[model samples]
Target chain A: AQSVAQPEDQVNVAEGNPLTVKCTYSVSGNPYLFWYVQYPNRGLQFLLKYITGDNLVKGSYGFEAEFNKSQTSFHLKKPSALVSDSALYFCAVRAFSITGGGNKLTFGTGTQLKVEL
Target chain B: GAGVSQSPSNKVTEKGKDVELRCDPISGHTALYWYRQSLGQGLEFLIYFQGNSAPDKSGLPSDRFSAERTGGSVSTLTIQRTQQEDSAVYLCASSSSAGTYYEQYFGPGTRLTVT
Candidate 1:
């Protein structure tokens, strides 16, 4: 079994300030991590993923995530936050399983990001 | 190109009733998935279909929930004897294949309300 955890239910930040949303995972095999953002009444939008290679991976909407093998974590980061960045974020993980659907993503509860101007 | 789509954006039904939700994956997609999202909760895996391989139904919460994909493009999820606890958003997603490391594009989802 594979799972992910986003410890914070909500995180608040001031405009133009750097922001981070933490995520951790537990997987038996090699892991594939992903980040997604959801606006009000909208579906989850793919942000970025960490399959392999550089620890730091860039994604959509001025967001990035650092995959730390030792820490077993993938934390999303943004150099400068904007008010429009406020939304619900989810962290998901998948391991190499033979069942189907690319080993069905297991998602965290989600984090609500609030950016104030 | 159009993305994955679901029908009956919103539905309300009473207890003991059966309902069906639909999904249309992107053209040529070979993998389709169903997940459930309750209010303020994370997505819960439901079922998965990949090409002609047998579906993975391990994540389904109960036998009352069932799904089928025909012609490898469209899928439908059916809930029997709906209960209030069954109310939630049913989301559909699709990927090019059941290969590891492929991104899954999601649909808008169908909100189901059981009274």
Candidate 2:
């Protein structure tokens, strides 16, 4: 079984300030982590993913996330927040049981980010 | 190319009625997925399709829920005997390949309301 937890329901940040949205996971094997963002009346957009190699992964819209194996966490981050970044963020995980991406993906409850100008 | 698309962006049906939601994945994407988002359940994987075949349907909530993909292009999710608990946004996503690192592009979801 695989699951992800986004402890924070909402995170408010001022423009130009750094922001972080924390996520943690539990999986039967090595995990594949992903971050997706959703805007009003829109589908989730892929942000970034942590497959292997570097612990820090950069994604779309200047967003980045760090994969901490020891902490069992993958937290999304941005050096400077923008009002446009306000949206619902979800963290997902997939157990590396297969080489195919068709494996089921377990998602967190989601975190709402409100970036103020 | 266009991204994934869904028809009937919003649907309202009386309890016990059946409803069908359609999804058109991105062109040439071989892997398609269905997920449900609701206030109570949050987000959950419903099923996955690789081309026209569905290797696993265990994620589906119950017998009332079923899906089919044809021609490796479009897919439809059917819900029978809808209940208020069935109200949620149904999302569809597709990926170019089944590779572990492949990203699943999503489509704007269908908002289902059971009255």
Over B7-54, each residue of candidate 2 has an lDDT whose tens digit, in order, gives 889999999999999999999999889999998466888998886454
The per-residue C-alpha lDDT of model 2 at residue B91 equals 98
Clashes of 2: 1
State chain A's TM-score for model 2.
0.95
TM-score of chain A of each: 0.96, 0.95
Fraction of native Cα contacts reproduced by each candidate: 0.63, 0.72
Worst 10 residues of 1 chain A by lDDT: A94-103
Model 2 error, position A82 (Å): 0.4
lDDT of 1 by residue, B7-29 (tens): 88999999999999999999999
What ranges in model 1 sit over 4 Å off? A98-102
Q: Residue by residue across A5-104, what tens digits does model 1's lDDT show?
A: 9999999999999999999999987899999998988888899999989999999988999999999999999999999999999999989766543478
DockQ of 1: 0.71
